[model samples]
Target: MIRLGGGPLERIVAVGAHCDDLAIGAGGTLLTACRARPGLRVDALVLSGGGGEREQEERAALAAFCPDAELRLTVLKLPDGRVPAYWEEAKTAVEELRGRTEPDLVLAPRTEDAHQDHRCLARLMPSAFRDHLLLGYEIVKWDGDLGRPTAYQPLSPGIAEEKVRLLQEHYPSQRHRPWYDREAFLGLARIRGIECHARYAEAFHVTKLTLNLGD
Candidate 1:
């Protein structure tokens, strides 16, 4: 297998359609990266759930997930499950974030996601950050929308456990869901780990990647 390395990840942008999306999809990756690179810059944007309890949940969750990074998050008030209707507002938010930082990596939803809000943001991302390494993170749902991902971020057993722990700790609002349990998170990680020959991992769909074989 050929490995592609993205050098010196000083900054990253993580966008989500709603609260808990980032934590569910990319929390382990965020924990692993932030631990390895202390003081990393993490800029996050959530299209909905602002000015409410969910926003509070997201802020606390991301802070814990990013660890020592300089984390800045924006949660908007757009109605949940209705992001496409607010296209102009969502587009402006993404564009403004683009104007602020040229991130080395971007963590976002996959265009093929079953959720409309997630798909909307995923489609909007490429328009703003055309040349960046954008990793489309996945959220398991009742729709059975999991796909074969092209990229893997291997997480240690400890990191995987920590990710689950943090998810449980930070997002109290999500606990009532039947699917929001330890088994669901760890089981997915275990499967992805088996695929990548690791103890655990987070998988991502890469729409495009540029390989540089030269030093």
Candidate 2:
């Protein structure tokens, strides 16, 4: 495998359609990033589930997931599973985030996601963040929409365990869900790790990226 790494690695913008989306999809990557750089700045935006317990869970969950980073999160009040209806609000939120931070990276939902809200958010991301690197994170759910990701973030055994622990501990509401179990979470990570030759890993679909190779 050809190892490559270069980017500001300082600021990041993480967007999701719902409360636990970010954690379930890219929590390991976020853990890896923040652990390497203690004070990384993360600006998180979600299109739905604000002004409620779900929003509360998001705030606490992200804080735990981000670790030492300076995290700022926005949970919009747009109804869940109906993001298309509030198209303007979703677009405006991403644009506003773009205007505020020149993020070195944007962690967002993949366009191929089976969920309508996720698809809408993915479609809106590129329009707002025209000249930035964006990694489309995947969420394992009943939709069975997982695809072959183009990129991988390898995680250590310890990091992988921590991610699962934090996810389970932080999101109390999600515990009742059938798929939200240790086996399901770790199983996917283990599979991704096999693909990347690591003990555990997270996969992503990078739609656009600028490479800087040097001598």
Candidate 3:
């Protein structure tokens, strides 16, 4: 398998349609990235679950995921599962974020995600950040929307384990949900890791990327 590396990333913006979406989809990658680049600037945005306990949960969760990095997170008050209804609001928020930071990477929900909110926010990405690398992250769901991700971020054994631990530790409210368990999280990572020839990994779908061969 060929390897593609993103060299010396300074800033990353992670957007999600709902609370826990970023952690579920790209938590391991964030952990790995933060460890690799101390003081890496991370700007996170969530479209829903704001002004509630979920928002507090997300803020703490991201801090754990992106340990020691310059993390700035914004949780919007848009209603959950109704992102498309608030298209203008979501678009404006995304565009405003883009205006503030020109990031090297963006971790977001894939356009083909089964959830309407996820897809709604995903569609807004390309229009907002035209020149950046946005790796569309995946969240395995009851809808069976997990598709073949075009990109992979291989995770180490320790990092993969920590991702699961942090998830279980931070989101107490999600614990009652049947799918929110260690096996489910590990099971998906194990599968994605197989695809990338690693013990564990986080997978992503990327619609566009500019490969630079010249230094």
Per-model TM-score, in order, reads 0.98, 0.97, 0.98
Output the worst ten-in-a-row residue range by lDDT, candidate 3.
1-10
Clashing pairs in 3: none
Error of 2 at 170 (Å): 1.3
Q: How accurate is candidate 2 locally (lDDT)?
A: 0.91
Task: At residue 195, give the lDDT of candidate 2.
Answer: 90
Give all candidates' CA lDDT scores. 0.96, 0.91, 0.94
Q: How far off is model 3, as Cα RMSD?
A: 0.8
The global Cα lDDT (0 to 1) of model 3 is 0.94
Which lDDT tens digits does candidate 2 get at residues 1-215? 65667556999999999999999999999989998999999999998889999999899889988889999999999998899999999999989988889888889999999999999999999988888889999999998999999889999999889889988988898899999999998999999999989889999998778777654
**For every model in order, what is the number of clashing pairs?**
0, 0, 0
Query: Which ranges in model 2 have alpha carbons more than 4 Å from their true place?
Result: none
As for lDDT, the candidate ahead, 2 or 3, is 3
Candidate 3 Cα errors over 4 Å, as ranges: none
Q: Residue 176 CA error for candidate 1 (Å)?
A: 0.8
Per residue, candidate 3 scores C-alpha lDDT tens digits across 16-83 of 99889999999999999999889999999999999999999999999999998999999999998889
Per-residue lDDT tens digits for candidate 1, residues 55-160, read 9999999999999999999999999999999999999999999999989999999999999999999999999999999999999999999999999999999999
